[model samples]
Target: MRSTSQRSVVIIGGGISGLASAALLARDGYDVDLVEARDGFGGRAGRWERDGFRFDTGPSWYLMPEVFDHFFHLLGTSAAEQLDLERLIPGYRIFFEGHADPLDISASATENMERFEAVEAGAGHRLERYLDSAQRTYDIAVERFLYTSFDSARPFLSAEVVRRGPRLMQLLLEPLESFVARRFHDPRLRQILGYPAVFLGSSPGRTPSLYHLMSSLDLTGGVQYPHGGFAALIDAMVDLARAAGARLHAGTAATRIVTAPGGPGRARATARGVQVRDPAGEERTLDADVVVATADLHHVETTMLPRPLQTYPESWWRRRTSSPGGVLVMLGIRGELPQLPHHTLLFTRDWSANFGAIADGRVPSPASTYVCKPSATDSSVAPPGHENLFLLVPAPADPALGHGGEDGAGSSAVERIADEAIEQLGRWAGVGDLSDRVVVRRTVGPADFRDDLGAWRGGILGPAHTLRQSAFFRAGNASRRVDSLYYAGSSTIPGIGLPMCLISAEVLLKRLRGDHSPSRLPTPMSPSPSHRPPPEGTIRS
Candidate 1:
């Protein structure tokens, strides 16, 4: 067993994955230093505040409680201890086109089953059968696959996996849309079951049926909100990382990934450190035993490192498919929106056409949208008389689409989309004066995503988890051409979402320690700072 006490790790990017990696490594006796170009943490999960209204700018839904629990458990704590969580009674509500009434999905499975039965006579049984398979697959994924880096097949060769191999393979090969369509006669049910694929940064028709496990998280376990917006969650995460002795540097950008030669004939390069520019625009070197790049993988590989040291370079990125970009409209309304739940999804009747529009690089006219009224749950987010709303409208990941503006002040494409979405939400949700009630308005579009987060193709999420891009086919955590350099985040192995980001960090840890066990890492005894700090000497360019 090698001692990690003397080793230093430099993490580029202070997103969820980067922060998680810091917490893990810092607790494991490695001196960890994390740097973020942004002024604060959370990356896409960041927040915005104005006019006494605070909005969680990204990732509203708090699903997959088990993943959250496991990640916190690894840190010798629990999600219950770190977060003040309140589960929504009716997980979420869905509004269909031309349907005056909305369909409410409850936290109870039996109640949800009855809700499905009301829609279609035989749909309840079908949903039960569907959920049974989904739950089993979900269990299997959490236990066997999510934590494994897929560096090899060793982690998945268990006896249980072998017995379930055929069914699992069938799921991986089939499309989620087809699977849902075959079981439910109603399009609403189909939309309800299939919409989860979008959370994986993929369309139902393109994503594998194996991802149907997403339903088990929200539809069954129910959806929750962490009392104060996601910003509070970010604060907790920063606290955890800091408590574990990891140092986070905000407004610090990594200019280059410094590499040293290694292997026979110096064939491969070893990561020696990172070159960074501080908020003051001063350059320095962070000499490290390991470099974990948790930024957009494409950005780190294509721009930060030299061509010779790159594994997945510009050409490889050109062939990869990114998830949809999104336009986020944040509104502060002068009263309660009682009609809308904590989470509401408006699904267009012609789902395929809506997806097709995005595929064709055009915004859907009557786009399917998701709305989150956090004020319904947390009063602290908005002023006493106002409510805060966050809406996500998926669009083509094209930066040329333009950026967001305050109060729809700019005559840009982003504001146009925001205006249309306002009208769309008003009509569908039966709120005639929705636009009139807006006290404050802001929009975040594809170009905003690109400029703010370095999103690949302005994507809000990472790559799509399609058949050819899921599981083992997904890019691994480590660089093939760079020793001791690792990747973690939505763009890398294990896929998207906040839970998946935590799992991605665990995968990075596993790869570093040569641990192939699929079980979660046990909590360490009294997690103390186990290493000395790295030198602070600045390196001139």
Candidate 2:
């Protein structure tokens, strides 16, 4: 292991990934500095308070508790002890049309199968086999693939990847709709099984079969929620980072990365530090041994880095649709709603036509809706005797489609869309005029996400999780152009969600610590003049 003195590091963007990196490195005895652009530190997955209602602005669901537990454990702490992680019983409910009862997904496979059987005759045994296949894929993937860094295809080109190639192909080749179609005959049952892929921003028919892994994560790991609010977990992580001796510069935006040639002979351009302009526009320079970017990959690649160090060209970005943007609604109801669970998915009857409209830049027909009733589980989120509800509807990230960008008039149009969506959800879910009962509410559109999070095209999760860009095929965790620059977040491997962001931090830390060398320092990237004499006399070897 490298000595502590050689490990001073700077992490850009105070997202979960950056904070995790800071906490882990500092705990390992490396001095760390964390910089964020916003007024707070949670990035897109942060929280906001308004009019007596608490809202987790991004990522309403926490699917994997172990990922958070493992991260905190690495820093000599336990998430269970620090944060009240409650296993959500029945986990979540799914609403499909023409069905007498909605399906409740339980933690146990046997119970879930029983529910499946109730929906479709003899589907329980078939679902068991389907889940068996999904679990196999999850076991192999979670163990060896998802946690790894793919600097190049070299790692995947190994004998193991070669041997496992067929299995991987088998996992993804059939397409989700086809696989689910073959398994169960009920339309509602198929929609329920295929609904998880919507989180990937792709329709079941278009999504790769490997997306079955999404179900596996939820089925195997179990869905959970923090006792207080999702923000509690963020607070705990920030505390852990601070305790590890990392200095956090909150409400600071990094304007640019200053750089110079790395090594003695001017071979590579190393990142010297960043030029930051705080919320007040006060400028400062933060120099460090390395720079970890946890911001949007496209933003960092195209705008932050100097032109020379740009690895991917604009054309490359143009070719990739990675993540789709959406409209999110936070609602505070004046009265309690009956029979609503902690989570619910109200899918439109015509799911295919809805995606087609989104693909064509028209308003999605029968738009899929996801609802979260935090008050169902924790009533403290709202005032006494009130309900706190959050709703999400996926839409195209680009503003040209009436999504609130390119034109300043987008928010108004988005509000209209939110109004329509709220009405539709109420009618479909039998919630009884939800829009009329709202005492407090807030609407977040694609443009709002872009303005707040600096998301490219208002994309929430990085790049679409398609087979072509999945796993090692996504953006590498390490920078191709800058020797000491790296990336960790949804845009990088293992890709998207809270758990993946934490795992990205682990991958980056391993690389930074493993590649240390004295000669790697003091390259041309230093801001001081090259003619300046070396500090002190060189005595000991």
Q: Judged by TM-score, which candidate is best?
A: 1
Q: Please list all clashing residue pairs in model 2, or write none if there are none.
A: 322-463, 322-464, 323-463, 323-464
lDDT of 1 at 427: 92
lDDT of each: 0.88, 0.74
Write out the backbone clash pairs for model 1. Answer: none
lDDT tens digits, residue span 1-541, model 2? 3332345577888988889888766665555788998878888777767677788877768876666767766766678778877777768887765554677887888888887888788998988888888877766676667766754455566676689889788767778889889888877778877876777756787778887867776665567888668787788888988976678988888888777787775537888778888778899888767788888888888888766688765667888764666777777888878757888887667877877777666667457778888878776688887888887877777654344422224467677777777887677678776778887767777766666777877776777777766776788877777877888988878787888899888777666655221111111122122122223332111
Give me the runs in candidate 2 sitting further than 4 Å from their true place: 1-4, 152-163, 263-267, 400-410, 515-541
Q: How many clashes does each candidate structure show, in the order listed? A: 0, 4
Best by lDDT: 1
State, as a TM-score between 0 and 1, how close model 2 is to the true structure.
0.89
